[model samples]
Target: MKNYWYRFKHYPFYQHKWFRISLASLLLSVFFFLITISNVYTETYSIERFTEAKETIRSPLSIENEKETERERRAAIQSVEDRYEISTEITQERVGYVNELFEAIDKIDEEENDSGQSGDDGNTVSDKEKAQDLQQMISPEISDALQREDLIQLITASPNHRSLGKELLTTSLYDVMNDGVTTENMQTGIDNIKEKLQYSSLDASLKEVLYLISEFAVVENSFYDAEKTVEAQKHASSNVEPVMIRAGEIIVTEGQTITNEIYEELKLVGLLSDDRNVYPLVGLILLILLIGAMISYEMNNYAAKRELDAGKIASIILISVLMVAVMKVTSLFTGSVNQLFFIVPAATGAMLLKILLDERLALVLSMMYAILASLIFNSEIPGSLNMEAGIFILFSQLAGIAFLVNLKDRMAILKAGIGITLVHILTVLLFLFLSFEKYSMADVFTYMGFGAVAAFLSTVLTIGLLPFFETGLGILSDTKLLTLSNPNHPLLRKILIEAPGTYHHSVMVANLSESACEAIGANGLLARVAAYYHDLGKTEKAHYFIENQMGITNPHDMLQPEQSAGIIINHPYAGGKLLKKHKLPKEIIHITEQHHGTSLLKYFYFKAKEQNKYVKEADYRYPGPLPKTQEGAIVCICDSVEAAVRSLKEPTKEKIAEIVSSIINDKLMDGQLNDSPLTFKELEKIRQAVCEALNGIFHSRIQYPTNQEVKEAN
Candidate 1:
């Protein structure tokens, strides 16, 4: 039963990540299709003319009837009377002409008096002569209107009367023409002049003459302002907003005949028949394909070559699908409150991926989740995408990613969550400010609250789900490494109790390997954990290893070189078995087994060769699969370098650097590090890091004088 269970757990078919990814994609697509299918299933109507509705229908969206609105605006603009300006200059000029005529008449009378013409006699200038003379002085048209008697009265009138007449005529013309006066209001202006003159002491005939002069002075001053009128009409039209049919508002009731207006509204809301429109489905498929391609490309490029196995792929797919599911489920409650979409825990996936995988892959997956969110949470516009939600998710995920970079502890997830919340708040405010809609404080706060909740929930869910994915998927997250690095771990505790010297040595090696691996961009935590367990098998025979022998005589001295080499060779394999028994991760087991590599045990090999001329080099060599990964290779170099440097009588920085370089060069010559992915540049960096660490560990210390020596010197 145990064997069957183990086999079932490791079954390839059940663990095939490609198939899991495909299934996850299909499920996501189905969910998206279910949510958005309503946009495609529009109802068809056949009514062409207006008809009475069987039931009342509301607009599906707010839209403007541009033609009707424009018509109303134009009518309003046209209702405003044409504006005009009064020309005071014309009034002044006409008054001056009348004065000149009077002056000319006075001049003619003076000349007739000087010539000794008697008044009221035939010899005096006749009224006909005066009239003929006035004709030449004024315009011929005005001269024709004046009668001989009128001319005679004007010539005989006093200067005060002429001045009074001129004042009344000019004042009435100025009053009437100063306002907007068109040809349509000319007679009205004339009547107003007559009324004003009637109250005067002037004769009725004189008032009538003043009225005629006022009428002639009146000219059209107001003109049509077509540009200003058109501009006003446009302003009014623009102020008329497009009527919107909000989401969930009814368009046409069932069994109701659709009118042209109703049909257009339905079409605007994407409710009209669109049986031939496969564009949405096609677009959805294309988007899915694009996401899949990105995932494939990113995984191929970012993950370690051997680490690009089914398990990691499964983990990636699981994280993505879980995030998408959270978004979809949250969308179900979105209703009219689209901001509820912010409560979907968008940062959780990026945080999980960053913890379980590489940060680059996490960033890529964050983008994918953001894009999917935009598509899924667009409930307000059925067929349209919600770009604001997409941007919000993008920044939220990025915040988590940024916070998780170089993270050292599991509790940092909470800090990252807080960061994500802040980012979400900022993102929500930015989008709100960008929108044309007016949002109340309550609405803004509500949306911001949702964003905060989303960020907090991401932290909560990531913390809650972390252990499960790490344990279930056998993923060696940094948190898991930290846990294993703890001194309280059973294996670590066992090593400490059974072989204290070995435990101390392992700790020193761990420090060296961690720094070295980190310098080369490798998994430093994994290297540290592996270093702690690398010598666990030494507990079974603590006295055989020199470090744990403490002051005891060397047991290897009594044993043959072959026997000592065999014992040394078996320790790595034995440690690997013990790790398996403890159910530790395979990566740790592999690192422990490969740290010794296949390098020849020079001490044993040379000693045996001196004793027996036929001693074989292979007999003194360790059985190894070499260092297959950079972390494992780093452990191998640190393990040897730590032991070598600890044996120095009085170590200096130079001595430590020499020994570290020697050990690394020997490993390279022996082909032990050939299988590792470390480049030449990375190896140089690792060498420098190892030297720096060893220098710190074995730096020269000041020696204080003994009490007796100090007293003697004094």
Candidate 2:
């Protein structure tokens, strides 16, 4: 019954790809739906124009009142009086006409005098003829108004009288026309001429005549400028912007009458019943689908390449959900009074993923988290997206990921956190300075504090949750490797105390394997840690191994070659069991078991061949399974190379290179590397790395002469 229950619980359906994707999609969709559901429903309120507001209504989003703003702008422009230009040509032409009329009258008087008309009848005839000539020379309106007697008297008067009258009338017309007389102000121009003549020395009759002539001369010099008026209006309109109702601003107070303007503002801000729009909801869903599709495509590709598994996928989704939830919860306190969105721990997910998974996956998740943050922390604008928050989150997450690229220990997360904090501070300051007119000193400081808190909280939370993810997911993170590589670890300590020579040999193998594995793009820390525990089974029977025998009598010489072969073959399986019993990670156990692979035990096989004329070569080989990963294969190669080179006396660079190449070539020919994913190029790189490391370890040192010998020679 227990076995049946276990089988039922571990059904195959749960492990299917479709089922996992559906589950992940459901989780993400639910999270996105919950955070953005408020924008979907249309909020209704009972109100009408001219009615008092029941309560204060704040704008949920910002909007522009374009029509009302334009009306106000036009009103401002119309308030300015129209401008007119004075025509100097009008004054000059009118003055010149007056001078010509006076000159013509003087010429006519000179003609009469030259004819010698001194009789009264002759003077009468000359005056009448002069009147007719005056009528012809001057404007008809001015000439017809003048009496025939006045014309004759002015024509017969002295030239001084005629000059004075002409001068006074010309001066009056010039003054009136120069002052810019428009059609509406023509009467005022006539009155100004009368006032000037009243203060002059001219007789009343002359003043009247001059005023009449000046009024006609004063044409509307300044006309209405239609183009200038239109231009001024356009400039005013261009300068005026739409009145914006900002998000969270109060649109109306309680008991205040909802006038037409107030109602329009409410509608603009989306507070009215008809203002509820589904575009934000549609936009949000599209954004979610886009982000989800990108993440799905990347994950699917990664899984196809065998870079990620079900466990890792589950961990990635779990971390993503947790990070998004943190952002959503943090957004609760964000508002106009306090823009606390900066306090969201955006870097936590990227840092955790980088530590638990590969850096590429971590960077992808950082972008996803940034998008989620933009939507989740949009409390200030409620239904709208906060691009500023998105930018801040993106840079902060990127900073954390970059700083954690070379993470060697758990403490590096704190340093990464510091870097993320500094990046956040800079980003916040940059955005603030960009909109310096909008933010106050208090707001800037508050946002800075939020950034600092976010950095600190992200680091603290990552440190707290890292162990759970590492243990629960069975992930072999670098921190876990560092932990297992400690000298105090039980397995390592046992090997150190029981088999000191084997322990030292494992250390040298670790150094070589780590460098070679890193050169081939494998996990170097895992290789080093696995090398430390690969020979752990030798501790159970220490002195039986030549390394631990320490110059003692050889026990292997008395044993049959088959028996020695069996003992040698059993160590890999025994070490795997020991590691498993101590609850070590499966990767380490796999490396321990696959290190020797199915290769033949050369010494024991050769000894057996000499002892017996016929012996099965297969019987002297280690149990099946070969190295299945690059790190495992590198450890296998380094293990043999270390032991073989240690036995050489006075090893040179050429000998070390030859031995390393020969061992790698033998392993390749023997098909020990068939299961590993290492390519031929990577293998060549590993060979070079191993040769260089061996040369460093076994290079000859320069010999020095003793002081006593030098003194004796002297």
Candidate 3:
């Protein structure tokens, strides 16, 4: 619970109300679409059933019940008459049942006829034999008619009469209303029955027997009609409630209403719902999931490829949110945004990735940007999916990212922007043929125009926004560092003028540091550039340092041990502050601050200790947060090694190696090398590089000596 609360407070998305709002809105939209789709299908089917019910209620049998309700006093007399009429109704019921049997036989014949199985084959049965087989299924009711083939022939001869006979079976109940058997007829029938009748009424059991016969006849007729209707519409495939279509069947087109065939396909794929509007929402959600996965993959790749600062990472997330908002707002006005909305994020992220991180990460970020663009373009309420424009923008970004893969200069980024325009035009025309199937040159041109505008906008925005992040956020992008590291820059030229020895030393150190860094898998360019600025503080009092003093009198000769120690320790800290003021990379600032990690000012420490018993060894130490990065540690080791090796009057490969190794070992033993990732193996490699560098720096030379050296040699 505590961890959850901490995340809620600290995590950016959890803390941001807008993220929550967007998430909730997505879920609500899906739910609303589900309800709408379900209701559409449900209401349509409900209306269908209601119409059927009204038709059923309009039958003639329904009117008979109304008439029967109107005569209550005559009901008793009518009941006696009704029995005689009901007795006659039983005979009609028998006839209706027999008619149903013939209707079933006729339907089977019709089916066989359509299928080309109506006794066309030599071995197949004739229509006479098929009638015999069907008569067995509808026995007793159809038996009497079957005994006379002449009666079947008569029924078959009148084709309309056969159909009319089937309709009469179901409509026999209508005779109750249409014929209207009168009370006069009923009374005359009952009086004639009295002559033979001793009992006042017929047996109750017998009346129930007659009613059962009538009920069976009605049910048999309904079944026969339902079966015939199903058989007639067999080609319509209406028998089964859920229909199935075979593969390769065309279900619907762009202008067609979703047909039963299409609906069945959707059902087969489990895409159709009790509600219908969910398809668009489903498409949107799928895009969201895809975009999210791509973003995560890119983020992971960035973390793997380069070391990202927390502040820079936050800036990236901020840009993503801003781009998402732009997509939403622009799509509302027109379909202009489309997948190109992702280009804004991609272009900005690519510039940052290339400058602040690496070029490979920029390509990954561009693809991720395309995914986000698709989601933004396809969003039901806010998406702007211009199919043609979206395809153009996607390839445009791909071309842009591909063109600028290893770009280091502003001109390269600009050239890539123009290249994106051409790529966009070609891709739009290609996708027109591939995706849309029809190509219109004018439409393609219009899409290309939009794409070019989008790419140009991205370039302009990238250029404008890059500096703000570089300066305000303290990020040292490649472009920013390149600009600052120019040799003609005022600070570098000033260093060259006032402290030529230190300037020369910095240049040599830059080469040594860069090579060593690359050897150990560290940032080589950063290490090299940092080496140049690490000793800028020596410019404040150039003559005080021995290298810059040269033939001039050294001021250190007059200074006390404590004063000289203070001067030595203060330079690195001063350099760090100066670089910070100029807004250099923190990595560079760290190299300056940590280059001289609390090592003794040996000359001053020994002198002070001999002269004054109270002069502590601690006071002679340089202020330090020891090297915290591999590059910083490399600079630290390189700094000491350079000065120690240069101090040798005559150098050898063995002496150079020993001196470099001793300096590195001393720092390691003193715990100054604890933070950086360099291991014993890397340190050995560095020792070798230093030895190789020293051999080249002080190569073997013949003694072409001064006058004293020449006289001694002769």
Every candidate's lDDT: 0.77, 0.81, 0.60
Q: How would you encode candidate 2's per-residue C-alpha lDDT over 430-528 as one tens digit per residue?
A: 988887467778888888988999899889988998888889988778899999999999889899999999999999999999999889778899999
Query: What is the lDDT for 155 in model 1?
Result: 65
Q: Write the per-residue lDDT of candidate 1 for residues 47-148, one digit (tens) a residue.
A: 344665555454433445555565666666666554455566765665566666667777776777777644455566676787678768776545665666
TM-score of 3: 0.58
Q: Where is model 2 poorest over a 10-residue stretch in terms of lDDT?
A: 117-126
Worst 10 residues of 1 by lDDT: 38-47
Rank ordering of all candidates by TM-score, starting from the highest: 2, 1, 3
Whole-model alpha-carbon lDDT for candidate 2: 0.81
Highest-scoring model, TM-score:
2
- Candidates sorted by lDDT, descending order? 2, 1, 3
* CA shift of 8, model 1, Å: 28
Lowest lDDT block of 10, candidate 3: 54-63
